[model samples]
Target: MAQNKNALIRYKTIDKCLQNRYRKWTLENLIEACSEALYEYEGRDVNVSKRSIQLDIQMMRSDKLGYNAPIVVYGKKYYRYDDESYSITNIPLTQNDMDILSETVQMLKQFKDFSLFSELIGIIQRLEDKVYTEKNHRDSIIHLDKNEDLKGLEHLDVLYQAILKKLCLRIHYQSFKAKSPSYITLHPYILKEFNNRWFVVGRKKQKRTNTHLGIGQNFKHSVEP
Candidate 1:
């Protein structure tokens, strides 16, 4: 895993260790806890360095990450939170944090149609709601420089949804080369884009028809099916 990603895990691990008031956590104990936590995530042993943990503690104690954790070393040996109720999880989002998360949510919305991002829809929605209240007063952080007049882009989402639902599409399309448009009832398996152009790759609905079709949606249809 990346170092930046691992740092988050270590921070959480250290926070958890300090939260357990029953355990007198030493430096070594904190390091071991972080390593074990990483092992569970990475499925391989991650040697958590003492310096890294020290830096993590320092970062948490600082306002840089918006986590001014009350970490204090007691008895000149063991570590604990100065405040009993303090945990990094309880830290409120700073304005800067909200801005970054707001920008991220907007960026993620553009790719929400992909299967990989399907599970993130709920998370994205929640993040959007969170950042919108703060961001509503200001201009959006991200804006697509897309040409709204692009052909077939409007139908892209409808076809993409059909692909996910395993539903067939009956579309009337007229390619640029042909004088008149043609219609095809297809089982659209995928929608691919190349060179700023979109194509639907699917097979004919008629059985024993070995010919498959790769068509674009630029063609106009006579009827809505």
Candidate 2:
């Protein structure tokens, strides 16, 4: 099934909120939590409706999305997961989930334009590897060039989003030629992969530099916008 990105975010936020058994979560609390989470991740304030969060909780309680979360109401107003160990992240993929993932991987592979899909290539490959491992019960057959110990990969998703949203980012980076790490404000434009390595192409936010920097995917990097 095709997923709604915002809905997924709301579900995750609700799940996280409910996981904190120490806090007594009400409907208003959940709505606030979801709104705050969306603002933090997307860098914008989104008005999360009560009905939307209600539906999110309903869906999480059902088997439709394979969550079947053990969410229960207590004291007639507060919500919490009955099973403390229950978490959506911990749920194993069902056979149907694997089938859908396999189809998605196959469909994505048909697109040959790597430039447009550079950042997604790693994520798709990881999904492909998981599907392959589950099916064959062994290691992946189709090996892609990836460094298991590669640093700064965690910044990929946030940077990609920032580029799409045209958000300026404050980055701390260290180049091999530099004596120490330097800090710069950047307007990220593209994520490029070449020669089995990834790079983020962007211009300096403060100075109008004609020559934009290509930040290589490596050690010691931080992004904040």
Residue-wise lDDT of candidate 2 within 1-225, one digit each (tens)? 223877898898888888888889999999998888888877988888989988898899999988999889999999999999899977766698899999998898676366656556567756866776676676433333454433345565566557656787777777777788777777776665545555677778666663234445533344564
Provide TM-scores for the models.
0.50, 0.51
Q: Whole-model lDDT, candidate 1? A: 0.70
Q: Best-fitting candidate, measured by lDDT?
A: 2
Worst 10 contiguous positions by lDDT, candidate 1: 140-149
User: Which number leads on TM-score?
Assistant: 2
Across 2-97, the per-residue lDDT of candidate 1 in tens digits comes to 888899999999999999999999999999999999999899999888898899999999998889999999899899999999998766566888
Q: What residue pairs are clashing in model 2?
A: none
User: What's model 2's lDDT at 171?
Assistant: 75
